[model samples]
Target: MRRGGGGGGRRLPKSSLAPSAASDRTPLLDPHVLHPRNLDLAFSRRDSDAASLCSSRPSSIGTGPSFAAPVTNFSDRASQAAALRVVNAYLAPAVSLRPPLPSAKDIVAAFRCPFKLTRSALKAPGTPHSWPPLLSVLYWLTLLVNSSESGAGGDDSPAASNDLMLYITNSYSLFISGDDDSVASLDEEYSSKARAHAQAAVEASQALEKEALDLESKRTKLTSGPSRLEALQAEKEALTADVEKFEAVVKSWTVKIQEKEESSVHLEKELEAKLMDQQRIAAENEELMKKVDAQVVNVRDVDRMQREIQSVERDNVKLENGNATLEEKGWELEAAVVGKLEEIEGLVEQCNQALRKLKPGIDFQYMLNTKASSPVELLGTSYKTIMKPALNSLADEARRISILKHDESVELEKQSQRNAKILSEKKNHISVCQTKTDEMVARLDSLDVEIGNHVSRCKADARLMKDELEKKDHHLSTVEKESEEFLKISEKKLEDAKRETDEEIQMCARELLKLIDSVTEYKEFMETSISGMRKDLYETVDDISSLASKAASTRQTSAQFVM
Candidate 1:
């Protein structure tokens, strides 16, 4: 039985499996086999002579089912993990069933029979011994037995065990078939093939012999005798003359090629110089652009400074107006204080006049009391009552007036001091403001100077740039002129080279025409020679045919005798 038979027999129902994926479709495998029937029947191993078989051999093993799964897990990591799971599942049982290493005695015992048989077979060589195939069968049987005994069962154990049994049975069948039958069959097949190959080889050899004989006969006929020595001598002389003419033409061509090469070198040098000039011009242009950009930036700065100066001037004007208003307020405060002082002085004079009037009334009352006794007594009482009251009131009025004057004077002095202090503070503030204004003016003037300097510098730089540009322009113009002159020279040289080449080509063409005429003459002579050779060849051919016919008759008779 074939090695694939067991694997091929494991095919489940068609309903459980799908067809293969189309070539263009993304390939996928079923995640789990969904057996429609779920047949739990244990498959018995096919009847054979061997004790056991293993199904690990690669054969017609079914790869479960094809699933039309979507391409969702496209990541390499997912694919790798899936592959690892598959490998682990497949290797698990194999690893579990792996046989332990044999001891030395067991190893010797295991190989002893086969080794002894091999030795005996090698010794008895003429017996047509065969050990390799038998040994392979034995090795497979041993593996089947060991794996079956040691294997730990899993989900796929039944299928694997069935296949293993089938492999063992197949190996047993091979052994039962026997070496004698296999050797006999091989010998018969080899013998038949050898016979056919021998027949073919014999026919090939006979044909090769006939061809060799025919060639020998033709060679003999073709060598009739040497002739036409004088004609060949004449042809050789003509060929030598053509060779000399060709050499002369070749020499002239070499000279012309050298001149053209020299002119090309000169032109190449001129082109390189022109390229360098162009590169330099490009560099100068870039420099000019950089300078222009810098100038634009400087101009922007100058404009910004001018705007700042204008704003500063406006601020100075506002500060000046504020200072003027403050000074006016100070003058008004001083005038109000002076008017209050003058009013205080007028109050002092009015107090003094009231005092003078009170003093006369008191003296008049004392004089009336002294003049009348009983009248004086009564008068004294009246005077004391009335005048005393009037005198006391007058004195109190006088004292209150003096105190008011003193308080007014003290307040006026305090007001004057306060005004003085205020004026001094105002003066100090004005001075500070003036200083700030002066500083601002100075700063404005400095800014103006700076702007003027910047303008002057910009102008100078512009002038410098103009001068540089003019220089570059002059240099470029000179380079252009030089390039033009060089180009003209190159053109002139190219024309000269072309003319020289044309003359050389014409010379070569004339020489070639002469050579062609010579070759035609030589060809005509050779044609005449060939015609004579043809006549001779025809006679030789006739002789060779007669000789070949005689040889064939002799060969046929010999072949018949041999038969």
Candidate 2:
């Protein structure tokens, strides 16, 4: 409990009691006299008297010499006795004693005192040179005792208190010595350290608050996960149903398309058949046209036939006129012949009359018949007979020629009639052929018209079919677009959902990492604090043990001196 002693000492008093005004006048103890060599010499000279003097003194002392009192003369026996009693009282609770006590050298060694001390310095009749060393030792022992007691009390550890006190004392000393820079530097250092610690604590608190908010958000997300998942599942199911419906519609459309294709194929086959029929009809019409062309007579052939008939008629008329002229000439010639015959007859009558008159008819006949009657007689005899017979023969020949001319005329008339009839028949035949040809041409025109109409009808049907197919194509395209849009929407929704889930996962992973880092930092801080505390405890224990040993040795020394 006492606290007045050396500068390094903890709670040791410089003396047992307050100093009197007379004691204050004495000079303070010399630091050099407390040297180890002086202590050894003084203890050697009074070794015998120290034990008796220490026994005769009382254990309790009310007051003692002040720190300023000189110990060079070694004359203050009461101060010595008071110093011994204080050492005994301070050590009694710390050490156990036996009958034979140990020496002061042993006590000094056990205390691990920084100063050199000897047993002779603690004994009675101690030398003045040993006094300061003795007081120094007592002061060290008192500090040790107080430190030990404080450690045991558990109020505050002596080592920590002592370090704080030392720092405060150093700061005050620096300030008193006018070392303002050093003091300010130290203050700044401490202030900076405090600021650093406060900043670190603020940052840590902010980090904790941020972490707590993150955890809360994460918990909220976790809590809502099932509901969100359910919603997504429902949406997916709906999309699946829509897809199924779309697929069904597509299937139906495909079936309809197949039917349409089959119908179109059938219609194409029918159209082909109609086209083939039309081609056959066209070929037949062409053949008929060819036959008609072959049968049709040219106008030049009819004109030539008509001209030939006119030429034949003209030849017949000419032949008839020639016959008539021939007939007239024959008539004239016959008349003249008749006239000559009459004249001849008359003349013959006359001649007969004359012959009769001149010579007799028998005689004339006989003379003509007579042989050689001369050229003149023969000529005369045959003149009338020859002339008569020639006349008769000419008549007969003329009549026969007339009859032949008549027959020739009749034959020529019949031939002309036959030719006229043949010409008329040819004309009629040509007209019939023309009429038939006209009919065929008309029929060909009708067939051509019908074929054109059929072709137009077929073209109309094809146009209608094309329009229908285009309409169907437009409808199908619309349906396909709708399906594609639906699918795209579903895909987009799925992608968005996936993105959200990924973000959540990443956020959770980051939060977990942050928690792990905070835990690691806290663990390291605790480990460092614990290790420092353990080291401090070990140091305190060592100091206590050393002080305990010193107290024990001092107790042994007091007991020896008391004996």
The estimated TM-scores of all candidates read: 0.14, 0.16
What ranges in model 2 sit over 4 Å off? 1-179, 224-236, 245-563
After best superposition, candidate 1 residue 466: deviation in angstroms? 12
State the lDDT at 298 in candidate 1: 72
| TM-score of model number 1 | 0.14
| Deviation from native of the Cα of residue 258 in model 2, angstroms | 5.6
Best by TM-score: 2
Q: Please, what is the whole-model Cα lDDT of each candidate in the order they appear? A: 0.54, 0.61
Query: In order, how many clashes per candidate?
Result: 7, 4
Task: Pull out the clashing pairs in model 1.
Answer: 52-168, 53-164, 53-168, 54-164, 55-164, 372-376, 373-376
lDDT of 2: 0.61
State the displacement of the C-alpha of residue 257, model 1, in Å, after optimal TM-score superposition.
66
For candidate 1, the clash count comes to 7
Question: Across residues 27-76, which tens digit of lDDT does each residue of candidate 1 receive?
Answer: 12322211111110111122231112122111122342222111112112
